[model samples]
Target: MKTICGLDCCGACDRKEACGGCLKTNGRPFGGTCVAAEWMKKGGKDEFLRLKNNLIDEINSLGIENLQIADLNLLNGFYVNLEFTLPSGQSVKFLEDKNIYWGNQVEIPESDRCYGLVADDSFLLVCEYGCGGADPQIVMFQRRQAGTEIKKQNLV
Candidate 1:
C-alpha cells in the first residue's frame, strides 16, 4: 500500500515482491522498525475498531431521533469526538474520556462538534446508527500525502 504520508512505496520499492508492502512490513520496507507501524501492528487497529464500533452502538441506543452526522474526530482517547445534530436543531457531542474506565458520552454542545477531518482522503471509519430519521451517519477519514510527516513514540 502506501506510507503514512501516502507515498506509493509498493509501486516504487525495489523489494515489493519480497516485502509485499509497507502495511505488511509495518513500514519497515528496507530496515528499522517504524514506531507508528509498530503501534498499529501491536493491536492498535483492533483497539480502534472496538472503540469505533462501540460508538455506533452507543449512538443507536440514544434514540435521539433524526440525529444527523454533524462531525467526528478520531483522535486517540485524549481527543476523540463524535457529534450529531438532534431533530430539535440542537447539537450533541460525544467526547472520549481520559479515564479509561469511563468510556464516551453525549456531553458537549452540538455547536462544539467542529473538529476537522482529513478533508480529502480515504474513509477509515463508516458508521450507520439506526436513529430512524434520514439515516444518521458518520464517516471518519484521512488523507495521507508524501508530505504528511508522521512521528511515533512510546508516550510512556
Candidate 2:
C-alpha cells in the first residue's frame, strides 16, 4: 500500500481517494482522480512490473543522474515520485495525472511549468518540467498500468 508522487515525496495524504499532503483547493490533477491506482487495477501485477522497468529505462535514456525515490504510502497501489538532476544542472518534477485521457499536456504559466501525462494501453507516466528563467527544472516519474503510455508533445 505504498504510494508516492513524481515530485520526490509521498502523496499529500495516505487516502487513495484523496491526498492531504499537497493540498490544493483545486481537485487532483489529471481528471480529479488518482491515475496510478486506476492502471494497477486494470492491468494487475505483471503489467506493473513492466511499467516500472520501462520508467527506469526512460529515465536512464534521458541521461539524468541523482535520482531519488519519493515516499508513497501504499493505499491502493504503489505510487512513487522520482527526483533527478538533468545533465544541464536543472531540476525536474513528475506527478500522476488522473484524467481519463492518458495523452494530455497542461502548462502552468504562474510557475513556468509544463506537464505531460502520457499513457499507452498498459502504462501512464506524468512528465512535468519547469522551463525559462533561472528557476530549476523539475520532472516527475509516476508509475501506471502497462500499455497506457500517453505522450504530450507540446505545452501551451
Candidate 3:
C-alpha cells in the first residue's frame, strides 16, 4: 500500500498510477530528500554532463562501434541494481548502463570488481570521478595509470 507516485519516496506526492522519475519536476525526482533528486540538484547533473562528453570523446577516438562498456551488478538489503536486462539479442551491450543505488549500502572494491567497459585492451578503465552513490561514472583514467597495472576480476 505505497502512495506518493507509487515510488514511496515523496512525502506529499499524490500522482496516482504514474511516475515521471527523473524527467518530472524539472529533473528533481519525486521526493525532496530522495537521494537521486538531491544528487541531481547538488552536482550529479554536472558529473553526468561530463560523462556524456567523455563518452562522446571516447566514441570519437575509438570509433562508434569499436568498443563496448561492461555492465555492473549491485546488491543491497533488497536486491539493488538487479542485472535483469531484457536481452536485445546483440553481440555487444554498447553504452548501456543501468545504475540503481540509494546510499543505504555502498561497497565498491577497487581491484576486485567488474570493469566498466569491455576488458579487451591492455588498459583498464575506471570512473575516476563517480557521479553519485548510484549513478555510474563514465570518466576513465583519471587516477589509474596506463598499461596492465590492475588485474581484471572475472565477473562471470
TM-score for each of the candidates: 0.23, 0.33, 0.22
Please give the ranking of all candidate structures by TM-score, highest first, separated by commas.
2, 1, 3
Q: Can you write out model 2's per-residue Cα lDDT over 29-100, one digit (the tens) per residue? A: 323444444344445445554554565455344443332222222221213333446888766534343332
lDDT of 1 at 12: 55
CA lDDT, candidate 2, residue 149: 55
Q: Candidate 3: count the clashes.
A: 1
The TM-score that candidate 3 achieves is 0.22
Worst 10 residues of 3 by lDDT: 73-82
Model 2 regions lying over 4 Å from their true place: 1-31, 65-134, 138-156
For residue 127, give model 3's deviation from the true position in Å.
22
**Which window of 10 residues has the lowest lDDT sum in candidate 1?**
114-123
Candidate 3's C-alpha lDDT? 0.31
Pitting candidate 1 against candidate 2, the one with the higher lDDT is 2
Misplaced by over 4 Å in model 3 are 1-17, 23-45, 64-156
